[model samples]
Target: MTIQVLPEQLINQIAAGEVVERPATVVKELVENSLDAGACAIEVELEAGGLNLIRVRDDGGGIARDQLALALTRHATSKISLLDDLERVASFGFRGEALPSILSVSRLALTSRREIDQHGWKVAGSGLLDDGSPQPAAHPPGTTIEVRDLFFNTPARRKFMKAEGTEFRHVDQALRRLALTRFDLRLRLSHNGRRSFELAQAEGDTARAARIAAVCGDEFLANAVTIDEQRLGLRLWGWVALPSFGRAQADLQFLYVNGRNVRDKLLAHALRRAYHDVMHSQRHPAFVLFLELDPARVDVNVHPQKTEVRFRDASVVHDFLFGAVHQLLRRIRPEPGQHHRVEFEAPAFSTPDPVQSSVPLSYGRNVSTPSWPVREASGASGSAWPLYRAGFAEPEMPAALNATEDAPLGRAIAQIRGVFVLAENRHGLVLVDAHAAHERVLYERLKLQLAADGIASQRLLLPEVIRVGGAEADQLEAQFESLRRFGLILDRAGPESITVRAVPALLIKADLAALLRTLCGGADDAESAEHFNEALDAQHRILADIACRAAIKANRRLTVPEMDALLRDMEQTPNAGQCNHGRPTWVQIDADALDRLFLRGR
Candidate 1:
């Protein structure tokens, strides 16, 4: 078959498959366009989670009447000039496919006017001919894009759409990611004609941070750590929240390459690696990192959606980011809050006599009191037994054990295991899993340290030499200096195997060869020495095994003072409520729950 060009409409629909996954996809694309247009103020209005309508109005450099038609044409972009421009692409809409792709799947309308133009023009779908030509009408200087009936022609796609509320949540998420990246830009969002959220334009970093807090919630801002660092000409600036501040999952974490929002495995790994040892296995850290580098150094044209990119020096960038965040954490450690210990006094051991006083108390007796005792016939004794009697069944009652106030909760009354300290509290009982408690306590402390002082590492007795395998080894050898800064001293020991002489003191007892091999084996294909070192540093910070060793063991009878100290320290520790394994360190039981269990009341 002879090769022929595909129709523009068909080509655009294909592109749409890549750029538009759902209503949120449309919102993301449109908002990115507004941002690229230098819009300081943008408003997004949604209906049916953008399935029925998505209107985006922006006060940016709007398209001219002549360019309005071009804007709707696939691959016709103002962002690029030649093939070389792909390497230096910076704008979020560099691919030039979003507009056309959006238009293909929906009834699209665009109204735009350049600031210089007296008025704007409106381009309607009616002008789109069978051959893909646009006829424009008159319209304003700013741009307003209206998309209606998304995926109407694609019934299969429509069928996959979730309920309206769930879909709206996705759209809300998309807008949030974009908004966080551009704090300087005022953003407004509404759903089905109702105002939901708005962010005022911010000027300085502080203002931007405050705006972010306003959008992401004040709790996030409170736990976030500011990062600012330069590596190989790349500048990293942004905030990363403490692990305690993260969502139940990683969905809340946002990353921006330059100013464009992106979700990439590499970035996520870097973040997780940064918090590896400092946080529990299930918990995640929230971060918003903006990487600024020369436009020529990165390749943003790798994908039409432009959400992922190829960095010129990815190893350097990864290390820079890991270090900056790691350092920020070290400087500002959030402190822990203290918890008070409660003790419950048990009843006396001696059983009381089974006797009922015949006389009634004048002070407590009520006028409705019965004149005689209510009794039930006893089957065996043929005698009346007081049914409503109190303290009358002495033979059936068990003797109570006495406890002294001076007795340690961890010794006389409770079970203290390897990492758990179980004790009886005032209301009921408390199980203090020490490892978990310490894990959470340490996590909070280390998180504060990471935020405040970055991570602290003890220098090794000798520099560790990690030999790489083949060409990868060469890459590592070249970035030796950068590796040293991260605490992985590497030198070419052999052709394939780098000799391990010394590792960071944090892993002195760890199998050095295995650790180094794991680091090298897991590295990206073209990772440099700097990258390996950064990875090693991140690995070093993970102190789960070590922390477990240092943490108090459960079942071990702790002295009253020790238990008191542990309780005191844990209460003061941030995030100490949960353990390193993501389990709660302690549980609360109210007096009502205990009384019900004991059958003490109705």
Candidate 2:
């Protein structure tokens, strides 16, 4: 083949392959252009899931009559003029490829009139036309881009589109990402001739929350916590759902960098680490967060779609994000009446079966029946019953109990079947899963103790020799020192085997051989070091299991004082809102809800 220069039409069509992947990509590009044009009110109209037609109208500083044709020319942009300008580009459409690329693959008509112009001008183009001349059109002091027959010139790309609903959903999601950051702008979206949503300009915090509720859902807003923090020349503000509000998919996680929606892995990793201890496995936390920093400090040109960014100081950003979210989650206490508002509904418990019944509920070894203190017919403790034999001694009530109205968890009133603690405060009633609450308390305390005193090593009476692959043995030898941090000591017995000398004192009862094999199976490369850290994380989970075993279990009868002690401990402990498994430990039922249940007001 002879060397030849590609025509302008083919070059644009090729660029479209990178810039316009689907209808959603077109919507994202056009909407971003409208935003960059300083549009306060934008309307997006779609037909056939944006495949047949997509019209975006905006009231902003429109293009000039002479510049209308330039807008459809490749590499023509007004956002940046010099190399230094690209380094600190802030606008969403700085690349200048969106318009030309989209125009190449679709039938596009750009009509605009600047505020100073008396009449608007229209310019239409397709892949066959390089730069169609602008002609006189109706009056409008803004821009309206009408794109029809998307990917019409490229049959291969058009055939790859999904079903109508699926494609529309992607477009809706793209609009939502832009909507979350620009609360001051009014955005209206319509699909298949029917209006889908119309978000008005939100001016206050309450209205902004309403906008978020409209986009994410009322459930998210009901369960979310508001965050506002500024530090180190960075500002992060948004709402993060509580750990109990976790979702099975990460679809609801929206992160905006400097007002541009992005899905950077660095941010995701930070969020994962922050929620690691509290969130359930395979569950994702839902959040709508906005991060703002100096534009020069971040690079948005790393990806074709500008959906990922590279930070100059990723470590600093990671630490800042983790610390901010971690601190907030740690101090999260259950709010009054929060349980009844959203998805945090309390689990209903039925009354326990009669103690004298012939069939006693068997919960296996994990649960034990509590020995009730022996009492005389007069209801006084018998002289033969020793206090120490009761399992727990009652502590003196603090003076804080005098003001029960101000108590966060109220005051414990009764124990239900040794599994639940029922209490009352200003917020009507509070029900607590006694076992789950105790488990979290013990786990937190154990972690703290471990951190303070370091991992305690328990020597094995007999060294266990485990066989493994050559790579596994090599990894075991290489990661010996790192393994020591988890109190796991290993020796290379041979090319295919390793000897385990000791394990964490807390995991003495665990199957050491099985755990070592699991650890060895995860070591494959340098990144596999993270797997080693995760193995150590497994040790903490084992510790959690131990705490669960030691915690007070179901069918354990507790006196009022003992219940009060547990409640006080829960009130003081950090991250006490949810258990280790991400289940809420306690729920508050407001007095109004209780009244509604009984029709007391009526």
Candidate 3:
């Protein structure tokens, strides 16, 4: 092929291919330009998903009449002028290719007036246009860009457009992402003459939370925990949902870096590692986090869309983000006197067999020993009955034990079928799954101990040998050291066989071959390898399995004292609201709900 300079119009259309993939892309570029222009209020109007018409008006500093034509030319921008400016760019639109590339494929009309100008000037452009003369026009002291028939000149690109509704959803998502970063600005969006949303400027923390609730959902806000941490010149603040509130997909995760939305692999991995043991395997945690640091410490020009960033010190950033989220999740204990209730429909009734019911049954003596003395009913802050009082021995009894109603999980009254614990509090009733609750408590304790002191290993009497395929063996060999950190000692018996000589004391009862196979299978890819390394390095998964094995099982009878001790432990344990499997450990039924069920005082 002969080398020749391509036409400016062709060059621009090619650039447009990179910058404008759909109507949403067009909206992103234009809105970013407006943001860089210092717009506090931006309004967007779309028709036919922006294929037919897209009008964006922003109350920002407008262009002068003399510069209206220059604005249509490629590579002209007021945001940056030097290499230093590019190194530490704070503006959203620094390349100045958005307008010209957009103009190359659409019919664009730009009208603007500076604050000092009495009237605005209008300039119109079509396909392959280098410039357009500014004509006198009457307008406000801001800018309004009207784009019509996008990709009209490029018929092939137009053919690739999706349906109107799908396109509109993309535009809506783009707007939502931008809205999260700029709570101080007002954003209004309308589609086909119907207003989609009109968000006012958010001022304080309360208002910002309200805005987040409006955008994310009310349920997310109710289940989320606030986070604020600063260290090593980095600040991360946001709300992360409780482990039980996790979603099936990661669509709800919104992360921002220095006021710009980014989708980064390092950040995602850090978050996943932080919630490794606490969350279920099939679920993803939801969060809206913002990380702030000096501009020079990060690079945002890795992609044309600017949705991925690179940190100068990735390990430090990773550690900081992981530590912040991990600490926040670790401190999520249920507050005293706090209660939550969920209502369910009444169960259907079944007729009992009269003959079976007529038979009399003999009863045995109750095993519960009520010898421990109970204090008088005090306020919410009353001291709890100590679990370790005199090494579980029964103390001298009082006449009656007054169980207060102010406890968060209430005072245990009975064990239902040796599985659920029934309690009474300020709320109507509380039911807790003893097995799941104990599993979570033990899991957290194991994690703490593992963090403080490394996992203890048990030597096997005889080494167990297993054979595997060549590919699996290669992966196992590559991650041999990482697996050893989790207390799984291995040696290469042959090319396709390995011998396990020792295992973590906690996981001694677990299936050794299955776990090794899983680790090897997951190490086939880089991302999965990193994930497995982190989990094994912390021995989190192994600890979870151990906790499950060591926890109290269902249908295991307990004394009143043991039941009370379990309740007290749950109240003090972090993240006790959900078990290792992400299922809720306990549920509350409020007094009002009980009243409604019986139609009392009607």
Candidate 4:
């Protein structure tokens, strides 16, 4: 090969290989240019998944008649004039290669009218058309860049493009990041002749949050917590949902660097670190963070799509953002109680309310007879019901550990740490965590009651008003009816807070502020009244710090009769060994494993 200068079109196609990866790439470049030009209103239209046609219009400062030609050429951006400007490039778009790269991959057209000019001029990317073509244009100053037949010349790149719907999703995601960062702008996006989204004139972050709620829905908003903090010269502000609010996939995370949307490994790692103890490894949190810093310290031209940026001090930025978010969450949302629901059998002789009666009842191996309920009538006199209720006698002989299918589970072998009750069965020995078993029992009972009619709620004597964030405020208002069912009285207090007058009696002693914050970041429909109440109850179960006190704990002694009753309760539970969090409440170790460990068997 000889050393030679490539033709203009050939050079452009080569550049397009890096810059114009897909329709979204084209949109990103053009939109950045519009934002750089200080456009308040941006309109984007695409056809055939941005293959056949793509157009971007912005009410930005347009090019003059003489400068239009030079703007099409490579390395001719008006964003910077001096070399010093490169180091201090604060604009969303600094590199001028976007226009030239896009023109290379498609049949491109740029038309603009300056504030001083009456008409706009059009330039064709395919050199076949003249530069100064007279076209019918609009009045105010703005720029319109139209691209047709994207990757028409390159079949390999076109083959990699996804389906129309999939491509549209990328476009929507990109637009969402931009819209979230720029709340004051009005953005309109349409694809395949259908208007997908339109954000009209957002006033502030509040308006912007509402718009995001509409787009991402109330589920995300309800579960999202505000993140606003500055350290080490980097400011991170946005909304992040709790770990429970996360999706199975990392689809909801949106990060912005300065004003440009970028995805850095550091950002992802920082987020993973922030959610280290809170969320499980399989789930990803829903977060939208906007990072603001001096642009001179970061290089946005590191990648062709301008998505990955290089920072002057990567460690400082990472530590600050990660630590700030992590600490805030930890301080605000301490560990909740182990589980939510609790179940207890109604006393045959007494009907004391569980919430009100805190006096411990006496228990022992000796079964006590009812004091005043000895009067019997009809055919049920002196039946086995009293023995079963008192947990003293079995109706039939106990089955062995290796019994046949027809055999029943034997008497309780032991209760470990008072929390778990162990019983011998035909095949094996079963160990059950009493709290988890009881929670399952209660959850089922409550669900049934809800399906039939509704759960009964007790109002508070004095309504307790707890302040909540704006996102949670909206969610509380949206899910008012459902929260009422959970015995929560939520009312909007201000622009960014809600007042909680009451909560589920089960969570009365909980840290109300933290619980509300935790609930705000859930993934289900917080918009629906039912979902809101579900969130409250779920939070009470998962986030309230009452489980330790209410739940049966290890080392607490249990009588033989109590152990027998606990075993029976475990048998009725659907999932006996695990809690709602998928953590094992009890483990199973067979005789064979014990024999093998002891070298008693081959």
Please give, for residues 321-382, the per-residue lDDT of candidate 4 as tens digits: 88877665544311111111111222334455789677554321101110101111112112
Instruction: Give the alpha carbon lDDT tens digit for every residue of 1-602 in model 1.
Output: 89999886778888888988899988998888898899999999999888999999999998877777788887788988887787677778876778888888888888887878766777767213233333454545579999999988777878999999999999987888888777788899999999888889888866887766766665566556566788688898877775445467776577888887776666677777766655666777777778888988777767657777777777877787777775554343212111212223322344544563343322211112111111221121111221112234423322222232221122214445455565544434445666566555544444444445453445556656645566656655666654444335666787775645443334455565655454454445443233344444443334333344334444455544344445545534434444555454654333544454334554
Ranking by lDDT: 2, 3, 4, 1
Give the 10-residue window scoring lowest on summed lDDT in candidate 3: 365-374
On residues 547-591, what C-alpha lDDT tens digit does candidate 3 reach at each position?
776567778776676666667678777767788878778877766
By lDDT, the best candidate is 2
Candidates ranked by TM-score: 2, 3, 1, 4
lDDT of 1: 0.62
Q: How many steric clashes between backbone atoms does each model show? A: 44, 0, 0, 10
In order of appearance, the predictions have TM-scores of 0.62, 0.82, 0.81, 0.58
Task: List lDDT for all candidates, in order.
Answer: 0.62, 0.77, 0.77, 0.64
Off by over 4 Å in 2: 130-132, 337-403, 455-542
List pairs with backbone clashes in candidate 4.
222-520, 222-521, 223-520, 223-521, 223-522, 224-521, 336-543, 337-544, 340-541, 401-426
The regions of model 3 sitting more than 4 angstroms off are: 336-340, 343-407, 452-538, 600-602
